[model samples]
Target: MLVAAAVCPCPPLLVPDVAAGAAPELDTARAACTDALGVLAASLPDRLLVVGPAGQSGRGPHPEGTRGSFRGFGVDLDVRLGTGNAGPAATERELPPSLAVASWLLERTGWCQAPVEGLGVGEPLAAERCIAVGREIGGRPERVALLVMGDAGACRTLKAPGYLDERAAGFDADIARALGSADVAALKALDAELAYELKVSGRAPWQVLAGAAENADLAGTLLYEDAPYGVGYVVAAWS
Candidate 1:
């Protein structure tokens, strides 16, 4: 069992730009998550890039310089998941794992857009967060499959899990629901997040995961839940 990781950092699912007139509910994002997982079911990846966030700078430069950032865990998923081969872009229907996070993102709102690039970050949680993930995996010498997607700041500073269980106490419920659901569905369906991790036989601890759960909370924003992986207990703290 080799411990490997991948992340996919994404901007707010429903951007003010992408969903101007359309009024999508968390359920809509849920619908999108459902469709996205279906796509992932057919096509799995080698590694998982987990992205993070960096919050917003409000409107400044450009037409709308409302630069939101992330320092969570998923950004690493975006870059690592498809690092080996960037052969071609995924089709609207194809839904690559990185962009697949959009499925979960869609569950939240219809008022934001996916990030265009990775830049300008805030406090990142990748190093400390992933360590818990990695340790739970126990540095297995096998292909560790993960689904990472958060903001860019956290994405940029991809690090191992350190002593970073500082914010697990004040998490809300929405974050919990998202991670819990994602983790559960991934495992049960053996098709989505849990589904794929099972393919690689990866596992992490609940307490370990809880340490970095805030990465999801701080950065998850509108994530529905953590899809299941293998041998891993879902640990989430949220409002």
Candidate 2:
């Protein structure tokens, strides 16, 4: 069953190496993510599942030691899902970028309390399907903790990735509230069509979280919220 969860943004810039000279811009958000992960560790879950957006449907079950790299982002850094075990061989597929960011976060925090795993939910997955996958994850007999990573709208400002959009602020505001209050219904009701138009990649994974927390009585805390590069990035914790 779900015992705890941490919501984070999956921007490659979260990695200092990837961000390079601009790394300082995200220091606060990075710190908040660290604190959020600490909360998950405090819950003492039997397992930790890192959920994030991926390129295609049914993209992962990235087991422990699965590898990820940031070479494409102009950094030659590599990360593994967990500390021990020899991961996938050269012939095996590597994790998607979202999962790679997740792996980086785990490594930054030195995660060691539970066995870590990764699940990549397709960006365009329907709410029903995402929720179903989440329910299955929550149904596990052992306590499960989640680290969900994805970005909100990237059209908040004129300089944003998606450029200025009048509706971006409202959409991000609603998401912040739902996550801060642990409102499952609000998350389930998120409009996928609108999200797609706004470039909100977090929709599917957040809905998955809504499903997992459906039966749990969780209290939430909004740790961070910002549009540093005009892309909405939020960090929250539920326990």
Candidate 3:
């Protein structure tokens, strides 16, 4: 059953090496992520599953020890899913960008309280399917915790990745409220078309979270919320 969860944005920029001089801008977000991981550790879950958005090449399950790197982003840093054992085959499948970011966070926090694994959900995955996947995760026999990584809208400003959109602010506000309160219905009800247009990669993953927490009865706290690069990045913890 679901025991705890931490939601975070998955931008590679969260890594100091990737952000370089601009890394200070995300210090608070990084701190919040650290605090959220502490909550997950306190839950004492038997396992930790990191879920994130991915494209075709990166989709599917990634066992513990699956490798990820920031080389593509001009950094030499690499991370593994967990310190647990994973056969050589595990390293053959690379993690998606979002999961790589999660791996970075786990390494940064020195997470060793639980065995870890990863799943990469597609951005275009239907909400129903996403929920189904989440239900399967939440229904696992072992106590499970999740580190969900994905970004909200990317069109907050004219210079944003998706460029400015009139509806971006309202969309991000609703997402913030839902995540802050752990409102499953709201998350499940998110409009996919609108989200797609707004370049919201978190929609599918957040819905999956909604499905997972359906019976967990968790209370939530919004740890951070911002659009530093005009991309909506939010951090929330549920326990």
lDDT of 2: 0.91
Model 2 lDDT at residue 137: 86
Assess every candidate by TM-score.
0.23, 0.97, 0.98
Q: Write the per-residue lDDT of candidate 1 for residues 1-239, one digit (tens) a residue.
A: 32211222343333323333443533343444444333323233232222232234311111111122221322322211221222233211223222333333432323122212112112222334434543444344433233334321111112311112222212213224444443322222221232122221112222223333323322222323332111111222122
Which rank order by lDDT, best down to worst? 3, 2, 1
Candidate 3: residue 55 lDDT (0-100): 97
For candidate 2, lDDT tens digit of each residue in 26-133?
A: 999999999999999999999999999999632867888878899989899999887768554422668889889988999999999999888888888999999998
Q: RMSD in angstroms, all models? A: 18.2, 1.4, 0.7
The TM-score of predicted model 3 comes to 0.98
The models' CA-based lDDT, in order, is 0.28, 0.91, 0.94
Q: Which lDDT value does model 3 have at 216? A: 90
Query: Whose TM-score is greatest here?
Result: 3
Task: Output the number of the lDDT-best candidate.
Answer: 3
Instruction: Give the deviation of candidate 2 from the true structure as CA RMSD.
Output: 1.4
Tens-digit per-residue lDDT, 56-131, candidate 3: 9888899998999999999999888999777886878889999999999999999999999999999999999999
What is the lDDT, from 0 to 100, of the residue 66 in candidate 2? 79
Candidate number that wins on lDDT, 2 or 3: 3
